[model samples]
Target: MSKPALAVLLTRHPRKPPNILQTLLEVQASLGFVPADALPEIARSLDVTEADVAGVLSYYPDLRTARTGRHLIRVCLGESCMANHGAKVLDRLRAHLKIEVGETTRDGRVTLERTYCVGTCPVGPSLVVDGDVIGRVRPDQIPALLEEYQ
Candidate 1:
């Protein structure tokens, strides 16, 4: 997360600290993932029980509670996407990037993840970077797309 986002999170719920989920989400979105040291501060700033925050963080995979790369790659695993060859595309991407699903590149350039859906079914087998949606992605195209980031 960015430094300014921390300020935003703090200000967003000044008198009233956010709930555990919101606090986690805020920190995660801002920092890409929650830092271990941040738990205490987040708990304090949000006025929530630390255990509650930890429990929620432990439960949700969507809520990344650790460091990740700067760029995020979300591949669709929904039925439509799968039918449209999403898995092959994902495999190709992983091979090209030399990183497995749910892992980040060594240089911190990209993080790969799987999503049940992105709701762009009309153009199934979608890939999202940051938040930009790309539909009809071909397996062979993965490397070229990633090259742009490098």
Candidate 2:
């Protein structure tokens, strides 16, 4: 995150009570990923150790330390989706992207991730590309769907 942005986020919550989690979330929302440079500042503001800040970040899966790709592809692994061959879809995506779950492609075009559910069980085999939820996804559809993002 840029210094100005970080400053704005910090000043936005100048309350007497400290809310480290909210501050961290604000930073995450502003910057797609939490910049390492902001940790010491956050720790100082919250009157805690840098390690404490890091521990909180590590506890939340939504918080990211590194930059993400242009597009995020999350495959749903819920029971219904899994039974509907979501695993096959994930496998095909990994093969096509040449990257495994929780990894981004070399070009930084896309990041593949796994989620428990997307609430599209009726359709099942769902995948979310960017922010669009795609249901009833198939292994064969991976290439064409990926093309849209690239």
Candidate 3:
């Protein structure tokens, strides 16, 4: 699916200095995730091996190999957030969604993820739902919040 876009990206940057990381980021940004099928083509374009491309993809937490749900739910696990019952919030979300962290729901509505420090320390236990920063989140609020997305 991403092969054509990758090819165009390669052609567009043919004269520029090789920046594998940036190129990969562009690919992910364009296609949501780094499609495995596009890796070989990307590697060939960059004059590198498939393993090298795969390594870059695996090394970055932000880079996803599989397609995520329509919405991404990131619960902060930083010091302030954890101290403020962030773990409980995560647990509640997982239980309510019936999916573990890093997994998407069967309906493909939401993907749960854990991140560190969203910089909303004053309102600890923050959650970012599809780029909306939600702070002071309570376990009981999860269902209601998720309902909005649904």
| Best candidate (score: TM-score) | 3
Quantify all predictions' global Cα lDDT against the true fold.
0.82, 0.87, 0.89
- Per-residue lDDT for 1-150 in model 3, tens only? 545656887677774556778888888787888888888888889888999899988998998889999999999999999899899999999999999999999999999999999999999789999999999999899899998997
- In order of appearance, the predictions have TM-scores of 0.85, 0.92, 0.93
* Candidate 2 lowest-lDDT run of ten: 12-21
Error of 3 at 34 (Å): 0.5
Per-residue lDDT of model 2, residues 19-128, tens digit only: 77778888877888788888998888778899989988889877898888999999999999988989999999989989999999999999999999989999888998
Order of quality (lDDT)? 3, 2, 1
lDDT of 3 at 45: 90
> How are the candidates ranked when ordered by TM-score, highest leading?
3, 2, 1
Off by over 4 Å in 1: 1-8, 15-18
For model 1, residues 11-130, the per-residue Cα lDDT tens digits are: 685554356777677777666787776677677777777787788988998887667688889999999999998999999988888989999899999999999999998897899998
Candidate 1: pairs in clash: 1-30, 1-31
